[model samples]
Target: MKPKVIRALGVVSALLFLGVLIAFAQPKGETVKVKGEVVDLWCFLEGGDRGADHKQCAISCAKAGNPIGLVTEKDEVYVMMGLKDHQPGKEVLLEKMAETVTVEGTLVKKGGVQVIYVSSVK
Candidate 1:
């Protein structure tokens, strides 16, 4: 039809295509359920400090933007992070430090480090 209309349609189509490509290019993770005690990764890994005595410290560290993690009953630790939508998983972890809870999330592992993009906790 009109030249301007044709150009606008072409630009719109290109934008839609680019959006789909970016969505597909994002990394995907396996859904998993992990049971563990939430801990501040800094003190937990650096000095084995965790559990009841370390609960307040863990919460403070999380509020200060330090990374949090889960220590499984089996002794496996998975770094806690927000979901792909950028949901702040640390907030959830902050409430449960030194307390065992079940976490549902997308599990991603790379370079020998494991992380959980948390979705739910109970």
Candidate 2:
């Protein structure tokens, strides 16, 4: 084989390999499903009251008795309480964390944590 031809093939192969790696590295913004026992509910409301200040809401929700937080077998954590349109104490079939009974929504990184904005529960 000609040296130039061999060099071209090598470059092509390298480009192809890089493309594949980039494709896999990108996060697919698809909803996934996950399932686990109801852990702790991290409610955004305070003292079971919906009309609380932001800081108060956080503290109150933590005190309220509900499973707003979810944990998977892999120790992935999610906060479900006080999100828009989501109800507390309701069983869910999450999507993004599909390794278990969880269902999907966009998994976002907030404050150095991975959380899914749950779209539905089955």
Candidate 3:
């Protein structure tokens, strides 16, 4: 094989390897159907705020652009996100703030933080 051809092949192989590594490195999420309470993350995590009494405040925080999250029956918490980029996950959960609701989405965990890209809420 010509030297130039061999060098081109080497570069292509390197690029292919890099692509594969990047793909693997990305956190591919899993689909989930979770029944939990949608809470304002800032108030919930900071002060353990939740329930009917906190509903109004939760809504206020959501309106103020605080992050929303879900806390499951088993005490698992997942930061909620939108299914697409440049969108806030709180859109769907705002009305359900401080209330228990079922949510369906893709859940991804990285660096000890769990995030769910919400697809549906009920």
Candidate 4:
């Protein structure tokens, strides 16, 4: 093959390899722990929401005559465990909002959203 063509092929191959590596390097499914204030919980049931935006769902629920059961924090590092099986309110077992506690569960991504399917809390 021509020298220029060979070099271009090599560059393309390298870029492709890099892309694959970056993709695989991301965490798939793992156990995680998170601590924060319970801000919203019910909207999570309808699906299509997760992460920082969870607070919005909480607020929305509160306005709509439903319990806004979501945990929110400014700097709390949520140890995200991949998705599992658990009810909305029963998943995270803290009684009040702003209560400091630890939650353990599988960090799962469903429909391009990351959430911890809580297993236990304290």
Question: Model 3 Cα RMSD, Å?
Answer: 5.3
The candidate with the higher TM-score, 1 or 3, is: 1
In candidate 4 the C-alpha lDDT for residue 82 amounts to: 20
Q: Give all candidates' CA lDDT scores.
A: 0.87, 0.49, 0.87, 0.52
Residue 115 error, candidate 1, Å: 0.8
Estimate candidate 1's alpha-carbon lDDT, on a 0 to 1 scale: 0.87
Write down the TM-score of every candidate.
0.81, 0.39, 0.75, 0.40
What TM-score does candidate 4 get on C-alpha atoms? 0.40
Best of the candidates, lDDT? 3
lDDT of 2 by residue, 46-95 (tens): 23222213334433444464445556666566665322444433334222
Among these predicted structures, which one has the highest TM-score? 1
Candidate 2 residue runs with Cα over 4 Å from true position:
1-30, 41-67, 81-100
Worst 10 residues of 2 by lDDT: 44-53
Clashing pairs in 1: none
Model 1: per-residue Cα lDDT at residue 103: 92
CA lDDT, candidate 1, residue 59: 88
lDDT of 1 by residue, 1-122 (tens): 69999999999999999999879745489999999999999999999999999899988888888899999988999998876555455766778888999999889899999989888899
